[model samples]
Target: MAIVEVIVPQLGEGLQEVRVTRFLKQPGDRVERDEHIYEMETDKANVEVESPYAGVIVEWLAKEGDILPIGAPIARMEVEGVVEAASPVSHAPQSAPTPSAPAAPPREPVGVGARLELIIPPRTRAYARQKGISEEELRRIPAASGNKLMPEDIDAYLAGRSETAATAEYVDYPLPQQQRAFIYRIKRSSQLVVPAVLRRPARWDAVRRVVEQFKSTPNAPVHPSEFQVFAYCAAQATLQHPKFRSQLVGEDTLRQYPHVNLGIAVARPGDELVTALVKNASALDFVSFVRTLQSQIRKARAGEDQADASIQLLLTYMGGYQMVDAIPVLVAPAVAILFAGEAFPVEGVPHVNLVLTFDHRLINGVGGAEFLNAVAQNLENAETLVQSGMAG
Candidate 1:
């Protein structure tokens, strides 16, 4: 029979190799074409590989956690086209080979003078090797001798070398204890890869009207408060500036979703962070959006089944807290994030500072600024949202 080889599929940019996380089929097992065969773990996400042809599994060339080169043969399957010729009817008698005893296990290296194997943290090992420092060399470093290689050890090593020589050996320090994980990723990824561009001012008048209507509603289960109004305004703004509602899928590819999914950042118990999504924000009116947002928040806080949000825009209300302003990161796959800061009364006029951070790859500085302006313009005229309807 013809043996077919299976290989990992190309995932995306900056992806070199993927870890084999799971295998759905084993050697000698029959599999169908297009059936899931295995999963690979990439930096972007886990991807499943499918069998290309219906065949009997012959061998698996790779194991789990094995980092295979691109296009490397991972498995072999025997096709049905060819078969070995065999004698018919009468069978020939054969003698089997005697089984041998298993070989002794290899012994570990002995003596204190033996070379020490340094286990550097992930993302740092590659840098260490590039500097012509082997794990043994790292272990020999005075600072690294008594303890595991920390940031300080790496820093000290680079400090002694020429600036140009150690330029690429840097590693980002861990964030502060009180920092939010999302915030950290956003800031770091943005600084390294993305450019922050602000859009024009959006009208806030329409948003103001909606908030007033919610406040006037009697016995409203969903609080028609200022924060809820701001959320609705942001969603409606997305409906208008559809580009801001799109996500940067690739270097030049921008993917726009048909529905506007809104993510609301909520502080969970024990200072943990979670985002509650309001699906189809454009379809729902002010009150409906608030109710859905509140319900999702409750579910998230209760540790219920909250699904991943394919959100076009993330709205974080720091107004409830004391934060005045923040530049939030564009959560990958999401194109933009809107931050609504605390609202304060200035000379009898209530005004809130709003910031919309967008992926510059998809939306330019002028476009981002304009989108923010559009949101602001709507909020300024909040009457339209309230007059439209309330939560059912």
Candidate 2:
């Protein structure tokens, strides 16, 4: 048996550190090699990291929310292999070894080695880089006001200047948990996904016909939003185009689904961006898809839980906005997302700007355009189901 160290691997470009957000396993638990054991949140993503060696966990050096640098060891394991020295343990502050010995207070002049992941704003980081001021230097200087050192703090540190209340304003608030998850996913989307956005004008005449029918019939139960209709079409298209239903699981690996989990964007209270899920959307008929989607929307508006992480395609509505096109951020695990704006007329023809954002690594512009054209063609010919009341 050998003792091995599992350390934090390099996360991504320009990233130096990550926070240990959650631990899936603890000391004494048997972990298989390549088993995910911890959730690490970098500046741009929150991802589960796998254990390198199959063995019982010996120690977990970092606790939840502890900021750790790349190559920092967070755990140790006993494996059946030739012994390899464990990665160096993180230098983050820990509790005292004995209760009788109180932990030493934090030191002034926080070391450069431990300050790589300091929380500084974009402007501050740029100014620090421009001024050749290290983040460690910021922590070394006594804060004139805020706990975090800022660009003005840098000036105060180097030039022997001071900032006043009149010239500086600071505000701090913790993000809501749901919002934080949304942000984490968005950052992953931006950093990891190679996005391709396609824009075209589509007229949802078939959708309007169905919505119009809903108005005439008293208590016409299913209120199918135009987005649902578009989603239904896109879902059907995914059944034909396997690429739209695929998710990038590795550098060159794609895991495609037999059916699509259609994700509908709904506005929730507290600035939370929730994607209400329609599970196995590709298997549903028009009416079932419509009712399920509308129900999800209603449940979401009532502050109910409907969103999940198993999204395959996203449908978002941005009505009453004037723009050339709106490109959606392709959420991770979902290769494609659709955006729709208000329908307007051009030369007596109704046209709605349809935008499709896809992961370029999994798909390309030609495939994306073909997919949108499929949705547009379905929307144009929606009268078959529209006249049938979409009851199927």
Candidate 3:
């Protein structure tokens, strides 16, 4: 039998190395060509590395959480003559969950300066090192988690400790492929994106009347979702202020998109967030907008990649939430985002708070306020939006 080396394949441009997350086959198990042998994670995405030949695995060269550069040998396999394809790359982050092994016994509290060796991602270890945090301190932090310690848990512990909370528990979740991209965008926004926020209370009386009128009317326009109403309003508002459809790409220049791709961030079951695109939303009228929104939901539930990274604008709502409004993160490249809180009736008037956040690097505070006010104005005149059929 000829022994061959199975090497880590190039995942994508600029991705030099990845952390081995799991191994699917043992050393003795035979693997089929194109079958997933192991999974690896980059800083921004997770990926599954597949075997290129049908062979019995001789030995594994990498372990979970071990970082390996591209082209490095990952495993050894015994194969016959004329080996097939030796390398294949999957750029998308795919699942390769490692089965959990027996947990180590909980260590008894040692002295203040005791050292503890824990198994975690390199990023977590680096963060702890950068902060001069010790394993003893990590042990003190409480987590409503599994056996493994993650970077997010460490970050949460630091945040709670800052507030001096004695007994703190943080939820550690398995990073879903879709959620990772969202988290990456959020963190990127918080890093360098200078954001300006504006909040205004919009009366939803006109909107509810509009929805009720449509539902009651025979052969009327397809009744729209409250989120759809907000989307249409946000879209129309962009027509008045084109900055919402623009991206900041230069020191003094803003690149405007030809179409307004309105991003809708919907929270799915399991607390997972997925973004769906309403392409050319401003161009579509009430009836078309509702149809497009429904299609977005259908595509999302079908496991399609709903989050369009190139979405020109974003709109989100907390319809059943108790809050008045929220300051949304201004995702980089995109100039602005909108968030609407749950509507509450006050003195027979339905009111909901609307918030607009813009990247201050491109749009000023005054511009952001005007855009938000315009969105509110469109919603307040909900009758004007849904009045026309075939508005697109």
Candidate 4:
């Protein structure tokens, strides 16, 4: 048996480092060659990395949430092989030999290698790039901690610069990274899409019965609610209406996804709002859907999954509250949002108002009304949506 080092591989496109999001395999667990061992969050996407050698896990050098550069050893594993001495991994891009030419004058006083002395995370660099901050500008900003620059430090520098540039007549306050990101999304949505709201009455008597039935089940993996049932129905409805799963890519292109990625808006303590995502909801069974939704909600409240743009639709529930109907803000990239309000007895029949805020650019008022009707119809037949195998 030979012990081999598992290092973070080169994730291309100029990315230098990645943050570990999850560990697929733990120590002492056997893993196969080319099997995914861990998942990492890059600036671009969350990627699952595959192992190069089949081995039994040894020890992890990094933990969840740790940011490490490419070529950094992340774990060690025991494998059957005569291990040879491995050379040190280089992070710098390898280049082919070229003819020597006249050297160009340096644009900045500090070289790129000198800038590397300070440990700036890849996420921080992405944020800086979005703000049009140059390397020289980054050099001028002071790190909050020992040699490492954080996103918060960048926010402080930008706030200070904005305050300094403002006239004495007005005062400026610096928002946290999370709040600023939320505001940016709101602004971007308003600028990009033409939004419109459509509301319809959905009979909740059937949905309520389904919730009660689940409550009687012993040891249910997820507790079912009217809101969850509605979300499930909405996700399933997208199978017929493809526009609900569509997103505006460029100015003129409409891209429809094959599966439904549902976003549930969760309000945590201190009035912080986050969206918990259930990726590929339409593909999962009813029980699986509810379980995944419950898990994602817990993660969102714990500050794990924030508002993910990949979600095709968003659902905000105000059930049990006195509110009847609300016009939700249509979050961009997602063309449709559903708002479920308090259910009330109308003519001896319990009904809830479902307001759908949709992008008018992608869906017309007629299409929105038809799609919502389908969701309402789905709720009316809640027993079929929540199958008998839920307790199994």
Candidate 5:
């Protein structure tokens, strides 16, 4: 039997790291070739990874909640080939070491008098070390929320220290893996590309009327919302506005997708942001569209899937909140994003603000404004859109 190393494969373009969420197969469990063995969470999606070898799992190099770089060895599998290699677990940076008795608590240092007990979690300690925070400095940092010193406390202390620094020197702290990935995309999509935003108001009365009618329907498939109506209309709008489904490639090229893969922003526990992607959203009938969108959103909330590059546009609905308007970020490979805010009475007419942020490299301000107008028109005709969708 050959002991083969199973590494974390590249899940997406420019994806450097992922956090292991769960393992479908434990050590010693048998697995088939191409069988899904584990699940991981990226910056914007949770995805299952398939094992390449048909083998018995020998050991796991990474544990649940561990964030590992791509191509890092995750497991050792005994396979049917003669491929021979030494066990990488001995020195693998991300390996899961054998379980042992918990280490003794760290004793408070001598000479320095600390006002409170030093209670630091393992993750927080690691974060402090990465920040070049000395043990003495950590001991002096105050914990605002609880007895335990959290990462946030370190951030707060650092912020205050920077503000009162004696010199102009700067300190760097490593960003969380998820945040780093998000920034990477933003840098590529927004900072590198020219992004333009346009705002317009749409009447929400029609949306409310249609939503109320749907709610009154006995045995309704799903309770409709203003966001749903807007999403359906936006998806339809993409058909008429091809540029909305296109993405800039090189300096002088654009790649237009055949279908509208709409991304809906979802906030998971801890306010972790993810996207619920609806593939070919423009093709589904309104009822099917609603069901599919709801299912995808549930999966995103549960961390079951991540948004990929195929998604051409994104929709962030702030209608449930008191927000009146927001400028949404345009993630890379997606040419545009739409933001909808809460409706308020304008001269006794209830209207919601819509902001469309688009990549100027592919869409001009005039085109962006026209697209926003199309979405607004769709919103104003919510009953017709809902009826057409229900008919399908």
Candidate 6:
């Protein structure tokens, strides 16, 4: 019998090793050509490896949680016509069929060459099932292939089919453990590269008024909220100060985006975080801007937002959690992050604290301070300025 060796495949550039996250097939299990065999974790994402030949598993060289380099042999399988293991003797007669029992449906053939597959964690899968969404339908999502499908892609598919019967039964799924590992890596990288500067008090009187006005006017096209107003103010401030709206491309070079693309940080029910981008925040008026922001936030909360844009800056507000201050890590490629905390009564006046974190490599202490000051100034006079802009 011929023995075929299964080797770890190359994932991507800069990826040299990967951790075996899971093994779908076990030793002695029959596997068909192109059948998914194992999952590997990389720094950026998780990948699945497919079997190269049809065979019976003879040995497993790798174990779960073990790290292996690319091109290393992971397993060995004995090809067809092999009699390595003895077949069990059956006691029952070999009858073609019983009239009362129907034949089971055929299993779908597994594809070859490392096709993508969404790896929903147990929690996410349970949640989805609780919401009555069929797992089969989710598996049919166009982008739900490869080592693992992203939560955002699943969300987008559900949102697009919201009118359909299955959409109403949609429930969020937790990210797989491997995806969490990816997030941890990102967080660690951010912490290493981005430094916390200062946490200053942010005036939110104008922002409150805008939110109240939108809440009061149910018929208004846009429902303004603190988050939307904050985004608007930040966008306007970035437009006024181009430096705050620029990205650090290299040590000496900064790329200033033509239009303000403000990224709003939305934390999912899980520990994961997804940012929804408001493209061209400078062009839209208050109502239009608010409407767009609301849509994007909804999409983000539902796990539908993906694709990073030319984001000049990021704004994360955890005011509802009563967080008084925070030193937010900057999303790479972007130079700055603005974290706003809960509004509180200070000296009998309502106020919120704004913490600005920046990449020291790109902007100096004075530059970061200046940017925060500009944002604070805009927030302080937000009401009058926004009203005037809307009127004009």
- All models: lDDT? 0.62, 0.70, 0.71, 0.77, 0.77, 0.68
Give a tens-digit lDDT track for model 6, residues 70-184: 6766676777542222112232356687888989886554333222234444454445544445444545665545645555656777677665645556645544433443454
Among the numbered candidates, top TM-score falls to: 5
Error of 2 at 255 (Å): 1.6
Over the stretch 1-392, how does candidate 3's per-residue lDDT look in tens digits? 66666778877666666566679899899988889999876544456777877779977755554556677667777777654344446455866656785656865543211222233444665576456454335445554476456777778877776676445466442355455556656664675578888888888887888778878889875877677777777888888788888876546767787668888777777777777888888787678888888899777766454554467788778887777667787665466789888898888798998888888888898888888888888888887766653444
* TM-score for all models, in order of appearance: 0.55, 0.60, 0.59, 0.60, 0.61, 0.57
Off by over 4 Å in 6: 1-188, 307-309
Candidate 1 local accuracy as lDDT?
0.62
Runs of candidate 5 with Cα error greater than 4 angstroms are 1-181
How far off is model 6, as Cα RMSD?
16.6
- lDDT string for model 1 (1-392, tens) is 55555556555544445556678898779988789889875555557877766788776655554455456556667766532221111122534545785656865533321222343443454455556454334445555665457656766776765555557576443222223234433443454346574533234344555555546879755556677777777788777788866765547676786668887777766666667778888778665677887788788677442324266777777766887667776665567788877666666566777777777777877788777887787687676555564533
Whose TM-score is higher: candidate 1's or candidate 3's?
3
Mind giving the per-residue lDDT tens digits that candidate 4 earns over 125-196? 668867856543565689988888988999999888887768567654333334434565676577677999
lDDT of candidate model 4 versus the reference:
0.77
* Decoy 5 TM-score against native: 0.61
- Per candidate, the number of residue pairs that clash is 37, 0, 1, 0, 2, 8
**Candidate 1 residue spans exceeding 4 A from truth:** 1-41, 49-193, 197-216, 219-221, 304-309, 389-392
- The pairs that clash in candidate 3 are 46-93
Residue-by-residue lDDT tens digits, candidate 5, 192-295:
55878899888988889888988998998788677888899999898889998886666777777777999998876765677799999998898889899989
State the lDDT at 387 in candidate 4.
Answer: 77
Instruction: Give the winner by lDDT: 1 or 4.
Output: 4
**lDDT, candidate 3, residue 17?**
61
